[model samples]
Target: MSEFLSHSHPRVALIGECMIELQQHANGTLKQSFGGDTLNTAVYLSRLLGSAAQVDYVTALGDDSFSDAMCAIWAEEGIGLSRVQRLPGRLPGLYCIQTDAQGERRFLYWRNEAAVRECFTTPAADPILAALPEYDVLYFSGITLAVLGEVGRARLLSTLGDARDRGARVVFDNNYRPRLWRSVDQARQAYRAVMHEVDLALLTEEDEQALFDYADSEAIMSAYRDMGVSEVVIKRGAQSCLVRADNRRYEVPAHPVHNVIDTTAAGDSFSAGYLARRLRGGSPQEAAEAGHRLASLVIQHPGALIPRSVMPA
Candidate 1:
């Protein structure tokens, strides 16, 4: 195994929000569940690692019943909850997903008042922020940056820097949602602040082009290289994913999925598979393949999380 997972149980902390998800069907009925980028990755990571690693989620939630249900779900998935904060008089975010015939999804969000907006800004978060640097790996996404706002992002940036200085690997998934940011420039600023600390960047090709206006995968890889990121994985839907690691470049093809369903958490699950395999000492090639495998399975399902019973062996 890699030195990062050399211990009996490697500890990983994923920071982001988990919202109340409502899947709208053709009949106009709503199927409610819980999902988020980092949270989805945390759940899949916990499942993939099993007893080999400790995966914790770091975010603030409401003291409402929805938050309770969310915690129960995370606990059942074997994810650590010590870092979760429940604030009084607040509620978790909510969003509705509508999928088309091709399994593409559209979302309508009502998250402005979500408790996670105050994630790293509360007094209770001081200790959590201090403890973050002790983990073996720290993971978050572009959506995480957008939700945390200015104050929270500043605190998270400092914590990430501290974590990297202590030899912990920082993983970033670029899941940019333009609606969440005031402007593209503001989002760019926040992303740049965290990019330098990232050890592995799991970037979606579309998001990169949308966020940075990068002409192609090469430009995206070149930019991260200049920022001193050692490992970069560009996730191109359907096409081969590009991996640049240890001065080597690879093109790992995506797993073929015949029947497409909801594409809600495809990238999140991909990040989880890639990180889980890498932590277990798999090469970049192997890790990317694992990612493709998990993502292929996820996209066939109807929600962000499929039945755990169907998890890949």
Candidate 2:
């Protein structure tokens, strides 16, 4: 299953927020963890690619103890924290996850004032914004766009344009949360504008269905294709994923598990594994299989990050 990719270490950055997460179990006991779409992807990407890539997390957080702990966690996962800012007087956001009997989770957020809100416009952000164009890849999500406010989002979109002009690939994940937006029309407009510069897209069927009311996966894929995204992946939990790249479409099946404990980060880990293979010169089909394999293992775990020793060797 091994393939040779470029020997040089590829630099990749995932742009988003990571918050303190409180997961309430069926017995009413709460387990604390850190979870976010882009953060989860960064962790898994670092783990999967090992030294083959340099993965950095781009965001802002407070100088509080919680922020320090999150940084420690990222360092332990081998993610570069140089681009992360520590703003004084601001704290990271806090959220809770409530899951049903089926392990499907619901998030309740209290992150409106997190320091990452000004990740782009703050005085400290000028250097970070300037450094972004140097990276080889930039990854982010819909939630990242929604939480950053209009000004911050505008700055990020502008940064993406500049980064892409410098040959950086923009990777997008559509992790949409309706509650984070002012209205469906506004969300649509924001997504459309940002996606115009996206080179790759990781889309969830349900999120797309809710955000754009697409008739089917093909419509969504076609829309992204028209927007100039060279590659698109559609993830359907416990079902096959649809991958289209270089004028070829691949239908890759997800690995199924009989017992699903916590569904946290399934998509994130999948993205990591897929990118790992792709960066190593594997075909899109091979990457999708790796994604399914890693995600299948992740959903069985209790938290966003599974023990590194327990991961695939």
lDDT of each: 0.94, 0.89
| Candidate 1 residue lDDT tens string, 1-313 | 1232455578999999999999999999999999999999999999999999899999999899999999999999999999999999999999999999999999999999999999999999999999999999999999999999999999999999998889899999999999999999999999999999999999999999999999999999999999999899999988889999888899999998899998989999999999999998888999999999999999999999989899999
User: Which segments of model 2 are wrong by more than 4 Å?
Assistant: 1-7
Candidate whose TM-score is highest: 1
Candidate 2 lDDT by residue in tens digits, 1-313: 2232334688998999999989887788998889788999999889988988999999999999999999999999899999999999999999888877787887789988989888887888989989999998899999999988899999999999999898888889899899999999999999998988988788999999999999999999888898888889999989999999888888998887998988989888888888878887888899899999999999887878888877776
Q: Which residue runs does candidate 1 get wrong by more than 4 Å?
A: 1-8
Backbone clashes counted, model 1:
0
Compute the lDDT for candidate 1: 0.94
- The 10 consecutive residues of candidate 1 with the worst lDDT sum are 1-10
lDDT of 1 at 117: 97
